[model samples]
Target: MAVTKTPIEDVAGDFHRPAEHDGVALWWLGQAGFLLRHNDLRLAVDPYLSDSLAEKYRGTPFPHRRIMAAPVAAGALTELDFVFCTHSHTDHMDPGTLPDMARASPRCRFVVPAAERMKAMERGVPPDRLILVAAGDVVVLSGNFSAAVVPAAHEERWQDGEGHDFFLGYKFRAGEKAVYHSGDCVPFDDLGDWLGVDSIDVALLPVNGRDARRKANGIPGNFHLLEAIALCRNAAIPLLLGHHFGMFDFNTIEVEAARSEIRSLGASSYAELIQPMTRYDIR
Candidate 1:
């Protein structure tokens, strides 16, 4: 049977609904985006809810076409408390999406890498509402919510003069439950060390493996499916939610085939290939 996707119009409504007690409700919004709800707090990470990439790269060699439509419009997410942009990439910190989102969610704050402040500002995040963070920084949102910033090695880790990372990952703690969203990362030597300390319940990782051809075309890649599973096992994270595929046709693997491979390896107990617009509640 085909899995019935929750309507795109209903995604915002679902996000605004109260979550289960002592748990986090997450909805995959295609690519590396997710809407997370805990208690009354509504948050999103790396939301790419626009076709800016497709519009920009229309006539280019790497035409950025979408395999699936955006699950929800950015303007519809009016109840958002915070949005985390892991890097300055257009897809991660969309120019078309952010402006509308900013206008919609008046009090919402955008968390961005300290190194990409200017880029984020250019992408429509107001300066006063931006919370700039570095790799070693911890942002305490409320008594029950907080985030720890960590470096992301997106192909290579780049740093500024003050050593703030250009790319980042976030370990968000909503009460006792923690979720790590590694924004466009490949495994690094100390990645396990960074994540192991957090006692993460669910890891939202990218499984769009890199290649020479894509790299030559200026498309940086992320973790392979096996590497993501290994990271979960090595870090002792109980669940791995794989993403960053099924959005772009050129950079994606066969989703069903990948799922079958995971099942064959007996890693389904801890790993899952996430589907767009589907909700997963972590208790």
Candidate 2:
């Protein structure tokens, strides 16, 4: 089946329109990147709308090449309100993307891990516009839009001496809907407890499972399809939007096969192997 990509030209218009459901609207921007909108607020989580990674790792074993082109450029998100960098990884924080996004959306604030403040700044996130958050902190984006910080184990959880988590995840509350974006995380024993899964309506998770070779090569891993499903079931989350594949050749799964398996599961109403640039609304 041919994949139909939503044109980059239409993205801005799509973001401004009201969602079909009474909840928030979401669009996958590839990898673990997501753009979300609710009411008047527009925000993005871990958006990697650039080719910096590919350029940096061109001849390396990982390569970091993109299988799909970026659906929208960072400079095009002129109305963006907030940008979340779950960590300092190039794909997540994106030096190339963030600087242009900052110049475009002058009022846009960046939500970064407290432990990665210096890293974020080095990647072009302005210090004044930065909203530093630790694991237990909750940031109120607006009257109805807020996010709770949670720890994420990118293979393993680590923290600095100041008790700030080096890796993090975000549980965003938009109106009455709650969406969880777990940034490059594997399933941890206390993950569900930290997420407060009962309140999460949708989970945006990575499905590129980890491996010894990748770990040894410095590429950490995240949840596989089974683990993502298990987390959703255990947490009682109704919807799961799976990502973190198809962006890199070395670290990604066979996406078409994965998508086929997800489709065959007879759970289309709940589970999805997310297509890039497509909009999903949760009610």
Candidate 3:
């Protein structure tokens, strides 16, 4: 029954917009967490932030200590709309951060997987605000804000009895743009078919420490190195944002290999692989 959290070192929640940046603004809060803000819509994905994460997973944590601090605190997020949790994992759906976030942004909704509803309820995310989506289920956010649930392959982990069968991936649409974020999984055969619909504008993928041989559930990773590139290539996304790296264990492939591979992809522009407390805009 252990939950995860991240430390909020810097509390000032000001984000600077680049002079040349266009359309919606993207703020990265390290690991698999990010904020995509457009007009009144604020979308947050994965929050492995606050001292709660650190305190939850001290020694022999799933991975290890993350190298960065959360860009802002859960209570500090002023304008938040919908919050999405790909699964019930601590890094993706943290116990510490969620409650504070619920308290802070009373207006934001938690769009989560069906399997994770009980966990979110345990964390105090209200019943009414919990929007559940199973694999293949779609939730439209106005004409612009929209999303579809896809299968997140945790094959090795599931086979080894480490992962739950209901873990999910998300395909989100914000106006003319489409983005995909995979919570945690090793690559699966059906990925292309799941993410093939509509021209994907951006893809936020995990290039982190997925090889969990001796760790908690042994759920490894979804897109390790080559598979991550294959996802962007198949999805036909203009930009691929590499996440879930550098936040934990400096010795893992997530910290070492992800950026180099992201830079080497065959897209018009390489995905903006970010470090902690940085923002990348989607035009």
Candidate 4:
């Protein structure tokens, strides 16, 4: 799917909008990134706005080519309560973008897996503002709001070791409502058990099907279309949103394919595709 760039109207304006709903307001920023706002708290996950990867690896075997322009600039962000990085992948943990965002929001805390501590530090993020989390770790943002880090099978668990926490998903809770952002993951048998199948209100997952073609090109992929539906059933997720597509010109699956697959599964009512820059009021 070709990317559709959403113009950044005004960074401050976007963040300071009047509340129209009571639950979580989520804005899809393309790729695996999202800007979530609930009351006074503001958070973002896996934002890759800069075209650094595209420029840096222009001639490399795995170049980061973007399908469209970024919706918002990193410098435009402010008053960020927290930022979450699920892993160290360039697209997810952008080196060029994170530093600028960190500098812009000096007091904002960055929540990442333990493996990203050093990387974050090297990017000049303040140690005091960095919160290293692991699987099963929970960080309470306020009295009724919290975020939980859960293990994700990206290729395999860590692929290195346990102490070095690598891939992860985040379950954001606001009172009783919960949203699970599965950062670039494939399904595992224990996923349902770990997520408490009946507790998930919204589940955001990657739908670029993993296959020999993608692997042969040296690009690791995520869950396929049909697999995504099955995963949603297994997890008992009430609402499922498809992502991890429409960002890259290469190494991505068409959005129509995902939409068609969901419809074919007769899961269209429960699962849907998220377009960039669109906000959904998850209740």
Best by lDDT: 1
Global CA lDDT of candidate 2, please?
A: 0.86
Tens digits of per-residue lDDT for model 3, 88-204: 767778887888888888988998877666888887688989998777788876656778888786544232133333677787776676667876766777778877667877778
Model 2 clash tally? 0
Give one digit per residue, the lDDT tens place, for model 2 in 1-283.
Answer: 0112343446767886765545777888888888988877889999899999989988988788888788887898888899998988899999989999899899999999999999999999999999999988989988978999999999999899898988999999977789999998999889988987347888899999999999999999999888898899889888888898888888788877877877787666677788755777666
Quote the positional error of residue 205 for candidate 1 in Å: 0.4
lDDT of 1 by residue, 1-283 (tens): 0112343447888888776565777898888888888788888898999999999999988788998898889999999899999999998999988888889999999999999999999999999999999987888877788889999999888899999999999998887888899999998988877776758888999999998899998999999999999999988888888999988889898989999989999998788888665677776
Off by over 4 Å in 3: 1-22, 59-63, 155-165, 212-219, 254-268
User: How big is the positional error of residue 27 in model 2, measured in Å on the Cα after superposition?
Assistant: 0.8
Error of 3 at 53 (Å): 3.8
TM-scores for all candidates?
Answer: 0.95, 0.93, 0.81, 0.91
Q: Under the 3 Å rule for N, CA and C atoms, how many clashes does model 4 have?
A: 0
The list of candidate 2 runs beyond 4 A from truth reads 1-9, 18-22, 263-266
lDDT of 4 by residue, 118-182 (tens): 87777656788899998889999878889988888876667345575588999999877888998
- Candidate lDDT scores, in order, read 0.87, 0.86, 0.66, 0.79
